[model samples]
Target: MAAVGGLADDRALLGRTSTAERVSDILRTRIAEGFFPPGTRLSEDSIGGALGVSRNTLREAFRLLTHERLLEHQLNRGVFVRVLTVEDVEDIYRARRLVECAVVRGLGAPPFALDGIAGAVADGLRAAAEKKWKGVSTANIHFHRELVALAGSARMDELMRTVFAELRLAFHVVDDPRGLHQPYLERNQRILDTLRKGDAAHAERLLADYLQDSLAGLLEVYRRRVGADG
Candidate 1:
């Protein structure tokens, strides 16, 4: 079992608001940030003591994450970070295509509020220049997330948040971070440029193909890793 180290520092983040949901949020970010990699058994004692929260609260937080598919509890064993299978990888990409392409296709108007998307792209570019592949990966996630934010729908935002977190679980299996993420940086910019020109149709096409290509590449990496590990 691994200790979810530094959860104690999150006490400040909890601030005056102490709740299961807040605890879950902190754990979720840590998971997505790859601090708690997949298959890591979460220590109840370590986490509870670190956060200074009750066992019930920590259990509730674990339950929420389990429902999100970021964690799983084994009977008589313990809770562990969920490791995504190949099927899960394919399904996640399918969901991404369905949601993301639709979001691009249903554009309302030209010259949209693309600052968020643009900023994410810039973030990725900076990270790439600095040889921080992981940072680039994070920025890529933020790029799509900001794209979904354009819809102004809370439900959509929340849905993609869970999806993105699940996707990160699969990402942990890949060995070449730069090879996986660098190619998409330009595609993200291209999509942004297409949107800037108000050509939603072209942007949607680009995103659709992009998702398909990404899925294929990820499936290959996932299969290779799964086989080697087995």
Candidate 2:
């Protein structure tokens, strides 16, 4: 719903070669990036036409994402980005704590690669300065992704991509982006600092606490929103 009309220029991708998986990946990333937000109905015709992919291909992509729980296909209503329940939010944080904390705990040595994490932190700082709340959230996500990348596993990265994409669904629900994400800017820095000191245990604890506190705050708001609607 966030303006898929301008995709005409992307026709080049089709000429090169397009597949259902690629289409799904693009949409998934768009969803994760907060472009087409939660509850927005995806127009098959508009998206397929724009991406220069066949309807069948696009539908397959939709099917894949639906399986991922990032999109839900309704009966004759169309595909809509999923709105996470409080339960979904809790589950995502649970996954974050398990994987992210373990990654921090399993660091091999001093002078671990902190470049990616550092860059993400810097990006967050810059976005904060510019008052780009969405950018800040994205940078936060990047920081975690880089953190997971420390585990040196492709499967882990792939899994977390879906996890983070799902987490973005929760993010789109909140009205105050700054309120949801601003406090974490400093927390992200602290985690990075802890890692830089070669203190894996300390970093792991920081990450675990960060996840717990984040879950608490997000649940509070999500409950209120859903309850108000109910």
Candidate 3:
């Protein structure tokens, strides 16, 4: 009986850890992968029951994502996935230009991690060619994310994460992952090549233009979607 009780307790502990981590991961992945549409309400009870967790555990997960800006809390209404407005998208791109351009400029020589960036770009291109928009989008983000990480600033990395999440939510609403990101794969490659050539200034300029053009294209799609839906 004692051994059985001990095993039960161990199982319970494992279950709790698994629930919390799974809740967090599911929320993040769905948000990133565009499964959870923006402006959609997320009910703690419903989500918890679906994931086989307690409401308390689900709330903890909500709190974490709320901190990440992927979820927003209303005074009494509850949490909803963040919706990026046109202004929000513009702000995100503006910030990206400022931070990412600085990151490239600061790296005097290409870091060894340029190989990883190249790999991510290649993967994104392949995904685009194969018409796997989601895969391409993920790889596209990975490419910029790795570039930002090259600067080696924890704070910058965290900021980039928030920006990236917002962008993903925007993609979810726009709903043409291919139309939005596929055209940019080769641009990403060019930027990588410039960095590899140790042309930090040129890379910075290219990234800024790329970000602007991409943001403009995405905003057009978003506007059309909003119009059609309305």
TM-scores for all predictions? 0.90, 0.89, 0.84
Please give the TM-score that candidate 3 achieves against the real structure.
Answer: 0.84
Best by lDDT: 1
Q: What is the lDDT of residue 57 in candidate 3?
A: 79
Q: Rank the candidates by lDDT, best first.
A: 1, 2, 3
lDDT of 1 by residue, 1-230 (tens): 13567687677646434588888999999998888998899999999899888888898899999999999998998999988888788889889998988888787778788999999999999999999999999999999999899888899999999999899998887899999999999999999998999998999999999999998888888888875232
Candidate 2 lDDT tens digits, 1-230: 44676687787666434488788889988998778989899999999999988887888899989988999988999999998887788889989999999888888888889999999999999999999999999999999999999999999999998898899898888888899999999999998898888998989988888999999998888887764341
The worst-scoring run of ten residues by lDDT in candidate 2 lies at: 221-230
Clashing pairs in 1: none
lDDT of each: 0.90, 0.89, 0.83
> lDDT of model 3 at residue 147?
92
lDDT of 2: 0.89
